[model samples]
Each structure stands twice: as C-alpha cells, then as structure tokens.
Target: MLRAAAATHLRRHIITQRRRIATPESIRAVAVDPSGSLTPRAVDLATLRKTTGAPLRDLLNLDIGERTRRQRRACVLPRDKAVLLQLGGLTAVINADEALFFDNGGEERPRAALRRIGASVEFAFQHYKAPAFELAVLEAVLAEVSSSFQRRRDLYEPVVQKQLREASCEFDGFGVDGLHRLSAFDGALMSFEAETRQALQVLDELLASDEDMLGLLLSERRAGTSVDPERHGVVELLLEAYHRRLSAVAGDVAELRGKVQAATELGRVTIDLNRNNIIKFNLYLSMSAVGLAATTSIAGIFGMNLVSGIEEAPLAFGAVTAGSGLVGAAVVAGFHAAMRSQKSIEQRARHAADDREALTSLLANMATVENVFDDACRDLTRPAIAARLEAATGKKPSEREVEILFDIFDASHNDKISLREARSALHRGDAHPLIT
Candidate 1:
C-alpha cells in the first residue's frame, strides 16, 4: 500500500511540472486553417502591423554576418501573435514551428532567418514596385518636358507651329498608352530606374552644349520675354534646345515601351477596321456599276424609238401623241428607276468614302498623339539604346547619332520618317538632323 501510494504521488508531481501552453484565440484559429502554404503552421505579417520590424535590407547585402549580430532583436506583434525576427543577409523568414521561444535559448539559425526575411522582402518589394513605377513614369515625363522645353526654346524653332507639332509627335511603347499600363506593379522598377538615369545623362550632355539656349526655351513662360525679339544665332539656339529636350524626354525607356505597344495595338485595330471599311466600299462600288448598267439599258431603249409610228402620223398626232406620252412616261419611269438605283449606289459609295476619310483622319490624329508620347519616352531612354546601337555598330558618333535620332523618330531602320516622325524628331532634336 505504501509503495503504490508513493508511485501515485510521483506521477502527480510529474504532471504538475509540465509546461502550460498559451495562445491567443485568434492565433489558435489561424493555426487551425489548412489553406496556408505552411500547412503545419500559420503566421500573419500583415496582421502584425505594430509588431513587425522595418525591412531588413541591412542584413541582405551584408558580406559578413557582423551587422545583424550587432543589431538588437526585431520583435513584431501582429494582433495577438509576436514575430521574433533575426536577420540573415537578404532574408527575414519566420520560424512558425516554434510553439514558444526555444527553451534551450539557442541562437536563431541563419538559414531559417533568411527564408522569413525573403518572404517579407518579397511582400514589401511587390508593394513598392507599382508606386515606384508610377513615380518613375511621372519623373520620366517631367524630365522629357524639361529637356524638350530647353531644346525648342533655347536651341531651335520656337515660333513655328510645325516645330511644336513635330515636338509633340512620336510613337513608342512607353508613350501615353505606356502610362496607362504602368500602373501594373511589376518588379521592373529597377529597370525603369536604370533607364531613367541613362536618359538623364544624355539630356545633361545636350543641355550642356547650349545652356543659355536651353534656359530660354525651358522658361518660355518667362515672366518677361518678348515675341520676335530676333535674337542673333536663333538657329543655333533652337538646335541646342531641341537636342537637350529630346535627350531628356527620350530617357524614359518605359514610355518608349508603352508607346510602341500602343502603336502596335492601335495599328492592328485601326488596320482591321479600315480593311473592313475597304471591303464595304468595294461592295458598294460593285453595286454602283450594276446600277449604271441598268441606267444605260433604260437610256438605250429610249434611243430605239419603240413608239415612232405615233409620232409619224400627223393627223393622228394628238391622239398618237397622247399614246406616245404614255410610252414616253414608261420610258421615263424606267430611266428614273434605273437612275434611282444608280443614285443610291453612288450615294452609298460617297458615304463610304466619307466614312473612310473621317476614320482615317481620326486614326491619323490618334497616331500623332501616340507618336508624341512615344517620342518623348524614346528620347528619355535614347542614350542607352544609343549606346547599345553604337556598340552594335562600332559607336561612330555620326552613326550613333543617326540611330539615336531614329529612335527619337521611332522609325524602323528600313522605314522612312513620316510627318509624325519628322515632328517628333524635330521637336526633340535638331530640326536639321540631316544637313540637307
């Protein structure tokens, strides 16, 4: 009896020593959810608005682990759950399996730390890219305007509407349509940033070539500037401004990309629409020909003198004339019937022509606007592509400049410049891009 009692007391003591588990109700519920990637675990960084520490980039690029070692532990509490963060260079992963702090008090493993950090960084990066892209696009556009203003005002033709038209023309992927698509937050922000920087460099060069000229054009809203002041060397001044502006605006590669895409889409849609119209026009043309044939047939019958006998008899002329009148009326009716069909067909053809012309005008106008956007975007990123094109073709300044100018023009290597290209290129760069 004494031994059995002793055994029972020992079992009770062991039970008392066991640690009691603690968890917030919310956390308990999270743990029960089976849909999470971490099937055996659950954590909510988003929920831990107050508890999560700042991004751990400091840990990511560290060649040595010393920096993270020196830093204090980052602890974040999402709702009722806490994340105890330890950094590995470039990652901040969570240790979801830990029910509580490891009782043995071992240092957090670096590998595990990295995975959590990566998850967080990926989240933050995903969030940051779109806003950054938007910001970059705006900056790029501003940069283009700045550079182009400098060119047109300081270096080249400021007064001519054509100059303005040219400056405003272009088509590239990143043009106006590009801006539309830029809201998509991809991790391409870095690429955008890189392209922007390159464009800025080119703009700097162009601006430096004629600072005074650029100053004037860029400040056209000049609180006090005269119209037709007739500055000496105005041609040179305009040239400088054009180059600077083109270089700057063309720097935003994304705009170029957007414009190109927009133009392609615009081209496809417009072409398809136009083609359909052409087919309709042809169908109408066939109808017109058929109507003309019928009209000709009615006129031919009138020429045959089908009721000449009535007109020949003078004594019976009045009655014959009356009968002839009936015959004439029949012929007139046939002519009118044929004429109506012919007229209808002709009218349809005219309408088709008018409709096509209107659509053509509209498409052209849209394309011009697209061109402007494309030109601006291409110019922003001109120098880098210039560099690439240069490298591809041995970097001859003349050759490179041509390639650069072509990019501004947004023309294919084989394609000649359109009025749109001319305007875009002219507005952005030297009006006399060609010496001729």
Candidate 2:
C-alpha cells in the first residue's frame, strides 16, 4: 500500500510540474516556391530543422527566448546549399530553388514588408521566368529594408523639424512647458537614432557578406568552375544598387541625428545661461536685502525708549535719517566692491592656470622639437612648423596663416624657422606664441 501511494504522489507531482512549464510559441513561416506560390504555415523546431536542413546547434539559435544569440547575422551553409539571414525581425533561409521566411511578429508586422517581396517575385516569375529567383528575392528584401528606413524617416522627419522650429522660436521662454516639450523631443530622437543605427549595422553586415560571397564566386570561376556570368552580373548589380540606396538612407538618418544633437546641446546651453542669470539676480536681491536690514536696524535703535540728549535737538531727526541712508548706501557699495574684487581674483586665477598649462605644453613641444632636430639651430620648413604647432596645440593653422607666422618667427627672412628662433619668439610677450 505504501509503494502504491508513493507512486501516485510522484505521478501527481510530475503532472503539476508539467502544467507549470510554459510551451514555446510556434514560429509562423512562409514557404516561397520556385513556381512563385506563397504558402503560409506554422513551423515547430523539428519541422524547421527538416525544412532548412540545419544542424541542431544552428536550430538552437532560433529559440526566441535566447535573445542574446539572435543578433543579426548571415550564416551561409554551403553544405546544405542554403543561406540563413536574420535581418531585424525577419529571418530567412534561402536555398537554391526556394526560400522560407520566418516572421518574428512584433508591433511592426513582417507581412507588410514581405508583401513587396511577394509581389516582386510574382512579377519576376510571370515575365523573367525566374532566371535567378533567389537573388531577386534577396534584392527585394534589401529594397524593403531600405524602404522601411525611408518610411520611418518620413514619419518623424517633419515632426522633428516642427519641434526644432518651435524650440528655436520659444528658446527664450524656456518655461515648464518648453522644457517638457524639449525633453519629449530629445527622448523621441534618441529612440529613433538608436533604432536607425541598429538597422544600419545589420545592413552593413549584409553588404559585407554579399561582397565576400561574390568574391568567392569570382575566385571559383577563375579556378575553372562553371559559374554563370549572367547570375554573377545580376547579383553584383542588385547588391550595388541596393547598397547605394541603403547608404543614402543611412546618411539621412545620420544627418537627422546630428541636427537633433546640435539642437539638444543648444537648448542645454540656453538653459544654463538662464539659470546663471537667475542666480545673479538672486545674489543682487540678497545684497539689497542686506542693505535694507541695515537701515531697518538703525530705525529700530532710535525707536527704543532709551534716548540720548540729541532727541531734543531740532536737526536730530534729519541727521538721523541722513545717517541711516548713508550707512545703507555704504553697506551696498561695500558688497559691490567685494563682489568685484572676488570676480577679479577668480579671473586672474583662471588666467594664471591657463598660462601655466600653455607654458607646460610649450616646454613639452620644445623638448620634442629638440629631440627630432638633434640640433637647436636646425631650421624647420613651413609645413614642419605647422605640423609641430598642430601637434602641440591641436590647431591646424592655414597655409597663409602659417606662412605669415613663420615669417614672424624666422626673423632672418630665410623661409625657414630655426628651433632656437621659434623658442625665442615664443618667449617674447609682443610676438604671437604658436603654443597658445
């Protein structure tokens, strides 16, 4: 009885465990026949393996739960004569004769994107009789991806422009509403930029893989393999055409990103300027309050019952009033003077620090020059001087500017500046120091 009871308990536990485990959703795939018929079907792991002839290791990468492993990639399985491509939300397995597309459904449906590919395939079959149907399908996929980017740009580009205009016009009035709007614009642009960059990266990988494959085909043909020139030419043309289109779209995205970044930076600087103004205003208000308090204290001292003989004098009230005004004015003037002194001190300190840094940089550059020339009297040409100045101070002076500066430093009209002359000119306060 005990053994039978234990067996029943074990069966119940197993049933509960099984019920708790969630099953993976089946992947929806479309089978594209060479004859140009589209058959939509549900595929499980086993079925997908049978259809693609991929190993279990490769099939395991298709697990939707393993997101880290599902990065965009092109896996060319020469053994199975197939190419597995994961482009954004769509994964495709293309064989010599047919292709299977698995759509990882999201907010953006793959069906809408695949519709273009389906139509193109049908048209190609009806007219061209499918000379290189697989390559054509790949080209259509690339076109759809490019179109998707263009559509996203169209949807957001106008809104971005409108926001930018509003921001520029209302920049002076950076109230709560303006700030909120700016934040919203920044957030939206950030999301769009990230998505576009990801798409561009995938497209780049695709192009690189395509190039490698084309190179391999050419090499094989060179090795006396019977490769079709027509197919090679078609593949090259399609890849090149889509590459240009995709590159143009990527450039547009990059330009938009740059504009958005610039706008955001400008907004930040404006906000900071306004904040500083508010701080200064508050400081002035505080100084005025201090002066007012001094006058109030004087009046309060006189209002007390304890008084000197001056209270009985005729001019006492006038004198007291005048004295209070002068004391208040003096207090405010003292505050102003102290603030000015503090500002002067800070300015001088900053200038001294900058001078120190410049001097250090100059010394380092002088050492470099000495080591390179092996003689302090070695004359450097105009280009050499420009290169050294750029390396030291990160400012690439123009040819004319360098030429003029070289003349000033050369001092001998020799069309060349010696290291000793350059050092001497930099030390003189009247001369324009290149290190600065």
Candidate 3:
C-alpha cells in the first residue's frame, strides 16, 4: 500500500511539473521600457496599454481580431504621443521611450516582416540606447526597406547575369536552341518585374509620405540651422539603393528585348534564305523533268511494233538504239539552249520597250546626257513591263505566256496605241475567252 501510494504521488508530481513548463501561446504581448529592457511575462491588450501608457482605443484601428483582413498600416497619433504600426500580424505602440508589441504568433503570420521589424527595433535599442519614437520608426522602416531591396537584388542579380551571359554566348550561333532559351528567359524576366514592382511601390509610397514628418522630428530634436542630416542620409540612401536596383532591372529588360528582336529577325532571315534555296532547287528539277520527258518520248517511239529495215543487220540494232538515245539527248540540249536564248531576247525586248517611251519623252529636255538617261530609262521600264504582263494575264506569266502576251500587244503598239491601252486590250481578250 505504501509503495503504490508513493507511485501515485510521483505521477502527480510529474504531471504538475509538465504543466509548469510554459509553452509559448499563439497570441502574445510584450512591453519594453525606456532603459532598453524587455518586460517579463507576456501581457494582454489591457495590460499592454496600462504598462506603455498608450490608449487601448488605438488597437481598433489595427483590425487585429480578424485574421484574414489584416493589412500594413502606420499612423502617428501626435496627441497621444504614440505611433501605431501594424504590418501583417504584428502590431506595436511605439512611444517616446517605451514600446508595447502585440503579435499574433500563429503559423500563418507574416513571419518575415515581423522578424525584420523586431531586428530593426533591437538594433536601434542596442546602438542608440535612447532613440526617440521617430528615430525608432525610421530605424525599423529603413531596415525593412534596405534589407528587402538588398535581398531582391541578391536573388535576381545572379539570374539576370546568367541571362545576359547566355544571350551573349548564343548571339553568334543563335538557332532553334537559342530561341528556346531566350523565350524562357523572357518569361522569367516578366515574372521578376511583376513581383519586384509591388514591393518597390510600397516602399516608395512610405518614403514619400513620411519624409516631411521625419525631417520635422529630427529638426526639432537637433535645433540646428542645417537640415536634418540623419533623415536625408538614411532616406536618400534607401532611395538610391532602390533606384539603382530598378535601373539595373530596367536596363536588363531592354537588353533582353533587343536580343529577342535580333533573334526573331535572324530566324526570319534564315527562313527566307531557306525558301529561296528551295525555289532554286525546284527550278532545277523542272528543267531536269523537261529533259527526261524528251528521252522518254524517244524510247516510247522505238518500243512500238513497227520495224525499220536495219533490224536485219546484226550491228544495225545496236547502232539504231545508240543513235536514238544520242538524238534524244541532243534534242533536250537544243531545246534548253533555245529556251535560254528566247528568255534573254524577251528580257532585252522588255527593257527596249521601256526605254523607247522614256527616251522619247526625255529627248526634248536632255540633249547632252541622253546616253546616261537611256540606261536609267531601261531599268525603270523592266519592272513596269513585268507588272503590266502579270495584270493582263491575271496570273504569274511564264516565259511562254509572257511571249504570247507580247505578240498580242504588238498589234496594238503598231496601231499607234499607248502601253496602257494595249494592256487594256489584252485584259479584255483574256477576260472574254473563245466559246470553243
């Protein structure tokens, strides 16, 4: 019985000790006094107000009770001699020498913001030891803004540098793989710009709004004829830092835009060059097809049942077959040469037709430089002839089609008609096909 009683007592003692171990609560409030000392035992809102001598009514402005609707806000209640600041879940009443902090220390809180504010406040307390409410506010805000900008710079600088390096390296040999890399870098840059803008804007608004207030507070404290050096120094430093980061990012974005443009243009140029090569290849294939057709025609004729007397001689069969093949090849070569010569004659005639009109028109004005003007006239007329021929045919005219149109127009020209009138006649002829 005594042993069992002792065991029960030991169990009770263990439970009591566990209860006394004091785990941290979700909601907590702490107060700090003028001598840079932290208060023992977290307090409630009422206790926080009582200890810091700040009015409890200001807590309503913080909107702390509701978790989802919290926002970052800061206001100086000069009449109460206090500053109320709420950044995410952390709210603080910053007085002349003491501060009361209320933190919703839950898992979903803005832990980074809270940590930044805490570290800034602690830094001020440890360094300045007797900083006023304005200095403390400045210290906290500067730390957050400076650290935030620096953090972003560190994070993005390497990425931007890598993108720049890749772009430079790939520029010489930009192709399909380079295009893919550029597209991915473009997307990443867009995301970075979007995310960085929000933070940059917030800090900008804060700095603009509080510049006067900080200046006034520092001026009153220093009683110097000169402007508040501390206010200018810190604010300007942060402003310059943020500005430098923005400039770097903006410059990188512009450079990437240029790179993307050059890459796109290069891709288009390559496509155009490839298309021209394909068109040239197809033209060669057409010429080869014409040659092959000639050879096939000769072969088909000899394969027929009708026989020549040469079939009776032993060497006649070989000689006739060989002669037929050679004749087919010779026909193809003659046809190609004839076509080429015709193309050249038509081109010359087209140029001469253009120059004839221009030379006639310029003859009355320019007597001395007729030779120089003749060459210029020829170049200008060549394209005009091609255009008119195309319009009259209602299709891209081949060498044969162009020659047919030229002959059709020649009669109109003989009748003392203008080129446009000849073109109209040809167009009418093409439009009105023969019933047969």
> Which candidate ranks first by lDDT, i.e. highest?
2
Collision pairs in model 2: none
* True-structure lDDT of candidate 3: 0.48
| Candidate 3 accuracy as TM-score | 0.37
> Would you give me the overall lDDT of model 1?
0.36
Q: Who is ahead in TM-score, 1 or 2?
A: 2
Q: What lDDT tens digits, residue by residue, belong to model 3 across residues 95-205? A: 656566664322222333444455566667678746554556545644554444343333333434554565455545543334444454445445444444544554455
- Prediction-by-prediction clash tally: 61, 0, 0
Between candidates 1 and 3, the one scoring higher on lDDT is 3
Question: Runs in model 2 with CA error above 4 Å?
Answer: 1-26, 62-79, 105-110, 180-233, 305-436
Best candidate (score: TM-score): 2
lDDT (Cα, tens digit) per residue for candidate 1, span 376-405: 322323444444333332322343333324
Error of 3 at 212 (Å): 6.7
lDDT of each: 0.36, 0.57, 0.48
For candidate 1, the TM-score is 0.20
All predictions: root-mean-square deviation over Cα? 25.5, 23.7, 31.4
